[model samples]
Target: MNELLSSAIKALGEKFGGQVSEFRDEVTLLIPPDKVTAAATVLRDEFTFDMLSAETAVDYCPQTNPRFHMVYIFYSTTLKVYLTFRAHVNGDDPKIATMETVYPSANWREREIWDLFGIRFEGHSDMRRLLMPPNWEGHPLRKDYPLGYEEVQYSFNFDEIDVRKPKGVR
Candidate 1:
């Protein structure tokens, strides 16, 4: 890690008592859902991580205790480095504090996560679907969501499957 990120990690550990882990040289601070907003605030106000580069969610289906991991990436223009942190949310009713207040750009990213992953963002100014229709039934990105995959047709089954597929004339 570079000097800036190293020092930022140290400061974060001291502030939040977060669990730090590394993957491919990238450091991630695993924080509880409750402290996520506070951590983001500190990262912005104190660490000079002025940009909320990205905010997204990951669903761990079939595991309920900590079902979702909300990932936030921050970039510091002054320091020229990136830092990532994640908040663990319960699967039963996954919810996390919003960072849009700290980083205005987070508004859309948070909405996307809420729309596709079914993760709620508390204190979000306007939480609504970004890509999906307003009345869409369920979050399509979740692992538990139906695949809706169709089988491919081969030469042997071409004639049989072709009859079921809609035909078009050009």
Candidate 2:
């Protein structure tokens, strides 16, 4: 890590009790769910991580201690660096305060997360499905989501396949 990024991570860790995990040239700070909003504000205003490049989530279902990990990627236009932030959201209440107040572009990104991952962003302006229909039953991208698929048949099984294939739908 460079001197500047090291210091910024140190500051965030000291201020928000964030934990750091690093890989190659990237660092991810895991903040408490309740402190995520305040920490994000500091990153934008104090550390100059001006752009919220990406906001997304990952679901680790069947292990509900932390059902989701909300990821926020920030880029510093002035310094030409990137910093990533993460927060652990409980399975029972998968929510963290919205980052739109600090980064306006989070508006749509958060919606996409909510739509696909089923993690809610508290205080979001338009908290609705971004890519899915409003009547969509559940977040389709979740690990526990039930997936339905049609089987493919080859020439060897054409007779068997034709027995069950519907005729009038097409």
Candidate 3:
């Protein structure tokens, strides 16, 4: 597994100038957002990574360069190995070319990332909210978002609760 991963990383770095870094069994390649589609094509064609297992994102609002990162997990059925490709984009304008062309399953995954992390997938067939409501204000998964709670209406008397009621008392 490590041998195949190293070979794949070497090919990607040589072909697309990807910043290949490995941590344990996971090999991450930091590719440019604009080159994402092309890079994915190479991975699929040359590396035999035909299955796209998942597409997700991480919001690093305070990062040095690109504050937003999109992660694509792919599996090579022939090689029986896993590879993860990551592309970085500015959080102010988080955008990356969609890989839906190469992997049809990326459609919904990309939508989920956009809905939760505000990472925009350009050229996606159906870029819509996958989880959050259409009228939702902000991306909840973003790290910059406040970790606060909304006030809830209590149906029971709070004064009576001071009597040490059971936890599940309704």
RMSD of each: 2.6, 1.9, 5.2
* lDDT per residue as tens, model 1, 1-170: 67777887888888898889998877899877788888889888888999988888888899897998888988999988778898888998888888888899989998899899998888999999999999999999999999866668999998898888766797
Better of 1 and 3 by TM-score: 1
Give the Å shift of residue 20 in candidate 3: 1.5
Better of 2 and 3 by TM-score: 2
- 25: Cα error in model 1, Å: 1.9
lDDT of each: 0.87, 0.88, 0.83
- Predicted candidate 2 versus true structure: per-residue lDDT over 19-98, tens digit per residue: 99989979999999889889989888888888988888988899898988889989999888889898888898788899
Per TM-score, the best of the predicted structures is 2
Which residue pairs show collisions in model 2?
Answer: none
Stretches of candidate 3 off by over 4 Å are 1-4, 148-170
Candidate 2 worst ten-residue window by lDDT:
144-153
Best by lDDT: 2
Q: What is the number of backbone collisions in each predicted candidate, taken in the order shown? A: 0, 0, 0
- Cα lDDT tens digits, model 3, 1-170, are 56766787888888788997879968889887788899889888877899998888877777837887788999988888888888877867777888899999998998998898887788898989999889998888888788766334355855555455444656
